[model samples]
Structures are given as structure tokens and as C-alpha cells.
Target: MEFSNRTRTGTHDSHRTEHDATRPGPMEEAAAVMRCIVCGHRAGYNRAVVDLATGSEVGGLCVGCECTAFGVSLLFGFRLSGSNCAFCERDGHYAIPSWRARTVETGGKTVSTVEYDVTEVTVRLCDEHLERLKRVAAAHARVPGSVRPSGPE
Candidate 1:
């Protein structure tokens, strides 16, 4: 999301007014950072949102909780506490990262660009929903032309 600030001046009193049209101000960001996603504890920057799958630099882990094994638990997948399942609102048991590539029309020809996007809000999924998503992803991968973008003719 983009944000811009607007300022207006009044001639009568020569007063300047400033207004911010963006949501989630600094206070909100700070509050979000303070809240722990795993144990619902307010430990400020001590807690992190860790990825259970690859154990990559997804986020942080709670210092108080027993989930301090950052990037060490591959067999038992776990996501941040506050994060819910993408498919369902249930507690997120696993964190999955999705990647895709596409072709864009540049000038008169189509150019393939490696577009990568990671979800800011972790995609937490329950066991049942995770299995379903895996199956769907597998099916799509098997289909030819499904993964590629339909560029300009």
C-alpha cells in the first residue's frame, strides 16, 4: 500500500494543517511488533514469526515460549501463534511459502521476468487444509501451460 500526506493552509489565520491518509500508522506498527504471534504474549521485539517449513528467515520466536528452536524443527511444523490458517480461521500449524513466475509485455515483445513475492502475513494452514493445498499445488504443477503466463500475441 502507498501513502501520501497532504497539507492545507488557511489564509485567514495562516494555519497549516497536515493530514495522513495512510492506515496503520507508526503506533500500529509498533503495537503489531509487540504482540507475539505464537504465545499471545506482549514481549515487544523479543518474539518473532518463524517459518516452520524451511526454517528460513521468516520471522522471530518468543523468548518465553518453548518454541525457541528457530529453523531447527523440520519434522514438527509450527507458525506464529496469532497467525491463523489461510484456508480456515483455525490456529496455524504450518507456514508455507509460495512462489510464481510470469511474463510481462514490454515494448512490442513479451519478456519473461522472474517475479517473486512473499506473503507478509504468514500463510498458516492446518493439517487438513495444508494437505488439500499441497494436492492442488501438485495438480497445477503437473498441468502444462498452467504455470506459464499467457503473454501478448
Candidate 2:
């Protein structure tokens, strides 16, 4: 599903406030229809899906609040899960490949976008996790000169 740029409106887990400055806006309707990568559950009310970069809620299966969080943990290992570096946070994914390759439009003013490669890799993860990440990256590969996520004006 395509991501949405609109702010989210709904109740969330006690710890997850929709207004948190760190969380991105809510998932668009399209994203809400996606099945959880971890639990295979369709996103329902209050699922814990979030942007993989930050563990903030994006959208997830309504049946369980953990689908979004779990899916990201599986794709990108969590610090507390004791998962290996293959799934752990890394520096590569957070780097913007090149300076000329990014841009941003903020407050009606255009600016250079932040480029980062936040994925981490370690030796201990199983091959299955690595393969999963590769597939994920392949699917999300953006077109050259495509804007990174912030929507049109």
C-alpha cells in the first residue's frame, strides 16, 4: 500500500500517543489494507504498525496491537530482542547514497532532504532474515529522482 501524508486520528495503545512529535502521520487508507508481515493479520483497529525507522505506529492488524512492531523487528532487528546484527540496526541504510540525490519541501520552501541508511547488519542472524530484508529493499526501491515520501504541495 502507498503511504499517506495526512495526520492520523484514532485511539492507540496507552504508550503510543497519536500526537507524539516523533511519530509520523498515520498510515493512509491504502497502507491500512496491508497484511502484517510478521503475523499475516490484516491491519485492523489500533494495530501497532509503524515506520520501520522509528517504532512509532503506522498501521497494523487490528486483532493484535503488536503486528506493526513485530513486522519491523523481524525485518529490522530490535535492540532488546537480542537479534544478530544482520537484523540489528546498522549505518548503511541511513546514509543518503549521494548529496545530489535528495531534496525536501518544507514550509513552502524547498530544501535538501536528509539521506540516511539506518539498516544494521551483524554476523549472527540467520539467512532467512537477511533474505527478507533484501526482498523488502528491492520492493521499496524508488525511482531515480523520486521524492522521498513527503507528499506533494
Candidate 3:
């Protein structure tokens, strides 16, 4: 199945109020189908993978939930799971959705769109690599022109 950065409703553990500040995509349909086993937000999720905690396998998580709730970003909207690391043979711990964006001229205005890379992979990473990648992503977000996730606008 395909895994995208779409959020679903219905949470699993978190009691915090629902927050869907970002934009929505085609995965909106998934929100009605599955709920997050962690936050219980009743948002969208991935049905292709299994939820290691309950083994329900119905839905996984969205990109925002993956970051705020789990601290592990998703890669191309995919919820990372499995056993081994994509970089090394060691066990995996974290996943990042290494998304790309670019501003283009559309209708005489600049529009930014999230784009995917050709080599994007939904592989897990060890703590060592995940930490490093998180650090780099953080640093990159600090740079000017970088798109960083902000609170509800």
C-alpha cells in the first residue's frame, strides 16, 4: 500500500486537544477510515503498516503526529517501521520525511509546493543516524528561506 503524510482522527494515548494546523491533502479520506492509536485525534493514517504497539495494522500516523508526538519525522509521508536500519544493519529507531519544496511562478505569483525526491526511501535509522539527521534538519530549518512548521496560523 501507499503511505502519505495524511493525518487521521481517533487517538490512542495522548489527551491533548486535536491540532490540525497544517494544510490538508488527498489523505483526508483516510481520516474517516482510521484513528491514531497514539493521540486519538481521529486523523488519517497508513493502513499498509502495522502499529507495533497494538499490532492493529489499520493505520499508523501522519507527518505532524510523527514529529510532535513521536519526535521522529516521516519520509515522504510514510510512517517508518520494520526492524533494521536503512543505512546500516543495526536496528532502526527513527524516521524522517525528508520532504523537498520549491517556489515557482504561478499565475504571476510565487507558489511553494512540497515535492518528493526520486531516491526517497521509507527506511528506518538507528539512534545515532537519526539524531544526526534531526540535528541537521534543525539547523537547516534555522536558515533563511527554510520552511519550518509553526503553530496554527
Predicted structure with the largest TM-score when compared to the true one: 3
lDDT of 1 by residue, 10-108 (tens): 111112234432444433354354443333444333333334454432432233332232233422443344457765778665554322234455454
Ranking by TM-score: 3, 1, 2
Residue 94 lDDT (model 2): 17
lDDT per residue as tens, model 3, 68-134? 4334434334443456666687765433333344455655544444422212255555766655544
Q: Give the TM-score of candidate 2.
A: 0.22
Q: Of the pair 1 and 3, which is ahead by lDDT? A: 3
TM-score of 3: 0.33
Q: lDDT per prediction? A: 0.39, 0.33, 0.42
lDDT of 1 at 141: 42
Q: Each model's TM-score, in the order given?
A: 0.29, 0.22, 0.33
lDDT value, residue 120 of candidate 2: 28
Ranking by lDDT: 3, 1, 2
- Identify the runs in model 2 with alpha carbons over 4 angstroms from their true place: 1-26, 43-117, 121-153
Candidate 1, 40: how far from true, in Å?
A: 34
Question: Ten residues in a row with the worst lDDT in model 1?
Answer: 1-10
